[model samples]
Target: MTNKVLNALANNSALLKWIVFLLAAFGFVWSMQLFIAGNAYYSVKNSIEVWQLSPDKASTQKVNSALDKIDNALNYFPNNALFYQIQGQLFEWKAITEANTKNTDSPTTDLTNKVFNLQEAAKSYEKSLKLRPNWSGSWIGLASVKRQQGELDDEFYSYLESANRAGPQDAILHKFIVDFGLQVFSARSFHYVKIKERLKHHLNLGIENPLSRDFVLKTIQKHNANEAVCRWLRDASYPVKKRIPNCITYN
Candidate 1:
């Protein structure tokens, strides 16, 4: 019985060695594949970053170059929100450049091109928001492009409201809403009520957040006489109003 066992072990030793060798080879191949894939992903991502940080204007050649980089990266990470956001930003930049183009040779043609660029930018931002609905930055980007195109009506204000909701703590978004309200609506317009509400909300937040406090104060200092600020001051607690010299003047 012992001799039979020894014979069986000897017969299967070569087969066991082959099995181990195949497993090691398979592991090496799999590891190499992962390493190659990771390196490609990072290289494309870095190229996208380089194009984004570049100071070059959004000329046709530069836009194409940046889009190409983003496309390559998307091939590897198709659902990446940042890539889509960057693409939207590039389109927005292109729109601004087009709007600023002074084609003395063909003014009508330049206007047509500018409109087309803004449309493209809006489309890009819509696509990005579809992928990432809660992205306040994309909303702001879209709102900015639309505002530049003179499309800031009721629907435009809705976008700003959505941006505020999506990024309540974003100081920049707060500032943008304040600026947009002041620029687009007359202080006496009912629409300015939205701006007042936004200010009050931020002021309440300012009790605990230093950034919010500073931003609120800065906005008040800049637009103290605006109806929204005066109304907010009037409606605020007496103590709060007393502390603000501008509010006293409004009274």
Candidate 2:
């Protein structure tokens, strides 16, 4: 009985030791990957910020360098949603840069690059959404890709609606949707009510913030949306009307 008990104890100790070894090995690998991912994340982040601030000045060579780092990081850490999101932005910027450089000399090649990059951006954004379904920014990125693609307006609006639903109180989102709504306000079809109601929601939300209110008012004036602005703010308070000089003046 003593020998049997000792044998069972030995077997259990051996299993525990193997389990600890495997866990330690996994943890070491994971930490190394995290280190790599963190370095790549900051590099990619700076690249994205530069592109957003001044896409015209962002060189293709630098963007390509960022892509290489991102691809390498993704290989090491495939499931990083933020990496995918930034990758999408990089591709989006590359697409526009390529398109802007288009000329008769290489129009076809530029067009091909634009289409391919935009498609890759869309794919990256979609993957990010799959990983993080509730991320409003990715939804907007997807919508932007659809809009720039300039086909299937309904699909664009659908993604936009998803963004709105995902972040009803997101100030940036409100402004973005409002800006786009006014852009095609006169020409929108099928989704007219949907867009208009969302515009109204954002406008109402905009009234709460001085900066947002001023921006919306100025944007409305810029778009020559006097009638719509006045009508939308019909039940507005005196403070609201005071900010919207154009609305009061036009009416």
Candidate 3:
């Protein structure tokens, strides 16, 4: 049998060579995929583990240590948007903790540190967004950090606008922007009105599902917004035009 196999391969040398080439190509492609997936997994694992350590901002040393670990991970996975996002979140969390601590037992020096942390958080979120422009969560995180940092600049609003544009169909994303706008912008301001209208457009585009309408109304009312604006429900021409009693009035 071995002699017969050798004789066949010797006769079909071209076929044997083609078979070897195919096998090598398949192995190379499989190895490349595994390498990419392995790197992604390692980056994500490091990110999760850093947060798992439960760094406390009140203990500056602990927060700093966790940050150092994250930085080290970034050295290997610089493009891992998730890690950058987590770094942004950790910095923001530290800022909140620092603010709360300042209210009770913090020293004057802590105020400077709190500001620095917020600034760093903003930069981190921006970096994450640049790496993953279509990530709605990263946009929202940037918006939140900017808001916390008292940034009412064009950049702050752009982050939110980009988020809504990136996920117009995402009901939760619309609600978040609306809720945040209501809290920060005056009801009569152009920014607030634009955000409300954009959210209304999203709902309308969603076929005006009754559930989304109800959710939006509830969220608006939660922010002490006038129930009358629920008028957008009927105005948007949703299929379910049934007026909500307390929420929607004929007047």
Winning model by lDDT: 2
Residue 135 CA displacement from its true place in model 1, Å: 1.8
Distance from true location, Cα of 248 in model 3, Å: 6.4
Error of 2 at 96 (Å): 0.8
Question: What TM-score would every model get versus the actual structure?
Answer: 0.55, 0.66, 0.54
Clashing pairs in 3: none
Per-residue alpha-carbon lDDT of candidate 3 for residues 1-251, written as tens digits (9 for 90 to 100): 69999888787998889899999999997687656645654654454344333333135455566567677667666887867877776787677666656754546678788888888887887798789888776787788777787776788778877887777666445545555655644446656665666655653543354424555555555666554445666664424334334543469
Candidate 1 residues 1-251, lDDT tens each?
Answer: 69999889987997899999999999997687556545654554454344333434346555656666666666656776656666666666666555555678998987787787777767767877888888876787788777778776777778877887888787546555655565434456666665666656555444235544444455555666345555655666665554445556643
Candidate ordering by lDDT (highest first)? 2, 3, 1
lDDT of 2 by residue, 1-251 (tens): 69999999999999999999999999999899889878988988866655543456776677788888889899997887878888887888888776666666877888888889999998998899899898777888888788778764778878877887887776556656666677778566555566788887787777666535555665677788778777887887767665665556534
- Indicate whether candidate 2 or candidate 3 has the larger lDDT: 2
Q: Ten consecutive residues with minimal summed lDDT in candidate 2?
A: 47-56
Worst lDDT run of 10 residues, candidate 1, spans 48-57
Every model: Cα RMSD to truth: 7.9, 5.5, 8.0
- The lDDT per prediction is 0.63, 0.77, 0.64
lDDT of 3 at 148: 83
